[model samples]
Target chain A: MIRITTPLTDDVIKSLKAGDSVLLTGYVYTARDAAHKRLVELIKAGKELPFDIKGQIIYYVGPTPAKEGQPIGSAGPTTSYRMDPYTPALLDKGLKGMIGKGKRSGEVIESIKKNCAVYFAAIGGAAALTAKCVKESTLIAYEDLGAEAIRRLYVEDLPLVVVIDSEGNNYYEIGQREYLSSLK
Target chain B: MREIHVNEIINAVRDLCIEANYYLNEDIKNAFLKSRDEESFKLAKDIMDILIKNAEIAKNENMPMCQDTGMTVVFLEVGQDVHIVGGNLNDAINEGVRRGYIEGYLRKSVVKDPIDRENTKDNTPAVIWTNIIPGDKLKITVVPKGFGSENMSQIKMLKPADGVEGVKDFVLKVVKEAGPNPCPPIIVGVGIGGTFELSAYLAKKALLRPIDKRNENPFYAKLEEELLNLINGLGIGPQGFGGRTTALAVNIETFATHIAGLPVAVNISCHATRHAEKVL
Candidate 1:
């Protein structure tokens, strides 16, 4: 498994390949459908984003409210395709990685290749286990959106698998094909 | 006639919501363990292990098993012989949902309107489905449905000529298109026959059945096994990592339909297919 940190560099992105297991560390920005819409609207309006986008990973999650003494609730990746409409714009602005589950649109894949970004899949529904990786979480913006609000999370050794890499090699395709062929 | 108070229903619904979210049901946990033992691929095995461990953490820590504690779905089987006193039934259920989400620290995922898209804040107004039965008891089942898998569900209207093969084809198409999105190791709830709307309802209801149980009808039970094998064959293993355990079970529920129509609905549920019940 590859050990990587957020605020990723071009070399780190390029070195990864589809199907590689990764343990991601450092901070990741949380945003879902509502937050993404607002963020994209800001980008279009030439307004500054809530946080800097360069070299950052965006986790598509809207976690449950944390208990009194916990960092966060059962935090797991939401579906990624829902954010497909706004992904390219973020990629264009130097978003280095995305952590979520499921497939991305062709347009998003093209942008990932163009911007040299990566897409990682967290084990979806493995929320309780995943929350253990989150050391801290602070609401960054859009509190009215509740769970859909944007929060910045400090994750330590968060487990992930590269689904789509900088070169646009997609593990969703490669892994399935390999497994099916082995059965034959 | 038996007299049932609204507060009884309210309290039952409240506890059901929290209980359903925090504890992973034994049948599902066993399915995970069985799948893990049977999964050939390393990654798929690892995922099953994580899911198993996640459930343990959620239970032991008293936390939600998944963040998308889901939009609350309450199914009520009200007895015809019972009289409901105190307040309105729907209001009581919604009140229960509100209290459970707030008190349990569960995520409130409901929006007031679909298009306007404003969070309801308290997760009020649960999608409540009620049926009148012959007994004096009320059965409440709460299912907190996460949109990740719920969004992947689909329904189709087929001609009577389409037959069983047609049903199989549609199920495969929906599952394939859903791919990794619904979080594989999914539970496929298939509703065949009935009108367009009833078919969808049956599909959702089918998910309430435990994974270990098969359809009561031998023929339908056989079809369930066949579909389970075919889905696993698709190589969309756990989280679509590719293996033999894409789905833990394929449950089919059917109702008599009109002469000209055959409506089929597929409700794809994630590995955390959560539901809890209390018969009061």
Candidate 2:
């Protein structure tokens, strides 16, 4: 497993390939469907984002509440496709990495290839195991948004897989097709 | 009939909201473990390992299993004799949802509209269904609906003559079309019979059953077994990255329907099928 401590850089993104297992540790941000919408709007209005995206990984998650002394609640990757629209724009701005499950669409794949970025999928439904990697947690912004609020997390060896690499390869699709073909 | 205050119901619902999100019920946990034993693909098995690990971490640390904390879907069985002392029964349920999602640290995924989509700050106005059964105790089932599997769900109104073969084709088609998107190894919940709406409900409810268990009807039980074999044969495996456990299980729930129609609904649930219920 490749261990990466964030803020993710071009080197980190370039190093990953589809199918490579990853353990991302360090500070990263969380966003889901609602926040993704807000982010695109921010890009459209040409306003400053709350955090620097350049070479940073944004995890598609809105976890359960953290109790006293806990770093973060069950933080796992959500489906990545929902953020596809905002991805190209963010990639253009030097964003290099994402963490979530599921496959990317044609447009997102194209953008990923063009911009040279990687998409990692966290294990779906394995919130408990994933939470063990979180070392610390803090609210970055959007507190009123509740779980949708953008929270920063300090993680250690958080497990993931490169679902979409910089070269436009998507393991989820390939994996599925391969399995389907084998059936015949 | 036994009587309980409305506030008690609200508190029960509120607690269920947090409990349902914070923990993975034992039935789901055991299903995955059993699937691991039965899974054929290395990649699929590994992915399932990740899922099992994720669940363990979530439970230990109080983290939600999935980020799509889900739209609040509550199923209520209210006793006819019970009296609600709270402001309103519906309001109590909504209030509980609001507090549970907010305080529990789960996402509020409800949107105001599907089209000109605007989020309703709190995940409120739950999709609640109440059945007035002859009982004094309130029974509530909470399903935190995730979009990955929910998006793949389908309903078909087939001609009665189309029969079992037609159902098989459609079920396979849904899984085939869904491929890796629904986050395999998947669970296909088949609600056969009933009307269009009830079929859909049965499909979702069917998912609550243990992943390794079979339908009670011997005929349908055989169908479930066959369907499981067919789905797993797809090799969509765990998280669609390939493996033998394309689908961990196939659950079928049926009800008597009109003579003219055979409504079949498939509610596909990902490996992380999270659901819980509490009776008070």
Candidate 3:
């Protein structure tokens, strides 16, 4: 069981490989479909984003509302490919990691190779257990979007599977192909 | 004739919404469980373990099964003998969805318009389908459809001549095209016949059934069996990692349709497959 700290560097990021399970600890952020659109828009305009892009990891999640005595609600990875278009830009800005489910695209794969970034996926829909990883969370921007808001979360040992590595390998696509061909 | 107050209906919808989001239907849960034992690939089995753990955590922790929380989709059956008092039946259902999403801490996933895309704050204005029946009880099925699985769902308009072989081809095509996108090891809900819309409805409805169970119609049941065999044969195991278990089950729901066309809708569900129903 390998555990690593969050907001990882390009060197730390490059060391990881596809299919390795890592428990992510330290600062993490959440974003989903809506935020992706806005982030992309900002990237297109060459404007600054709310948080520093350097060595940051964005969790692809929009958790349920917190109940009594809870820090955050059920939190899990949303599909990753939805943000594929914006990923290369983020990677270029020193973003080292992303957490989501499913496969990524060619451009994003190339970006990972160039930028030494990696992608991880928490079990999709395992929201509550996911919330346990978030030790501290606060809204940094876009609060009006409700769950879609950009928030900084301090996490401790958040579990994830390395789906895409800095070397430009993606588990989802490769795994699916291997699985499909094996049957026939 | 039974006259039900509007408040009662709203309350029923509200309760149903919470129940649906919090709990995974027994059948869907069973499907994931069964897959754990049967999956041949080591990685697929491990992924299944994560899914099962996710479900247990969601339930015991009183969390929404997925963070997407899904767009609210309710298939409502209203009896002809029942007359709603005070307000519109549709209003009651929407309000119930709003209340449930807000009160239950479920995420608000509905968008007002597709192009403009404004958030509906509370997963309101559920995608509701109503059918009038000859009874007093009103059935509300709350289906929270996550984006991943919903995106992978399909509608097939095959020629009437193609028949079951066509369905087999179409279903496999969909699964193949979907790849890892639907979260894999999906439950395939196939609806045959009816019009385009009705067939799609049947497909969504088919997903509510138990995973391994066959359709009551023996002919369709055989299709389910054959399709199940074919889908698993694809080797798109859990999380689309290599495995013997591609689909947990293939459920087929057929309806009477136009003579010239054969429409099939595939409502693909990820391992999460969250749905719950309440008849009141």
Using DockQ as the measure, the top candidate is 1
The reply for model 1, stretches above 4 Å from the true place, is none
lDDT of 2 by residue, A38-138 (tens): 87789899998888877777888877667678777666677777788788888787777788877777988888889888888887766667777788778
Enumerate the candidates' DockQ scores in order: 0.89, 0.54, 0.64
The best-first sequence of candidates by DockQ reads: 1, 3, 2
The positional error of residue B59 in candidate 1, measured at the CA in angstroms, is 0.6
User: Which one wins by TM-score: 2 or 3?
Assistant: 3
Model 2 chain A: which ten-residue window has the lowest total lDDT?
Answer: A174-183
Write one digit per residue (lDDT tens) for candidate 1, span B126-223.
Answer: 99899999999999999999899999999999988999999999999999999999999999999998888899999999999999999999999999
Worst lDDT run of 10 residues, candidate 3 chain B, spans B233-242
Tens digit per residue, CA lDDT, model 2, B1-280: 5767777777777788878776777766786787787766566777777777777766765667776678878888888876666478889899889888877877767878889666786789798988898867788888888777888889999999999999999999999877766777777899999998999999988987877678878999999999988887776777777777778789999999998999999999877676778888
lDDT of 3 at B114: 92
CAPRI-wise, candidate 1 is high
lDDT of 3 at A111: 88
> For candidate 3 chain A, which ten residues in a row score worst on lDDT?
A175-184
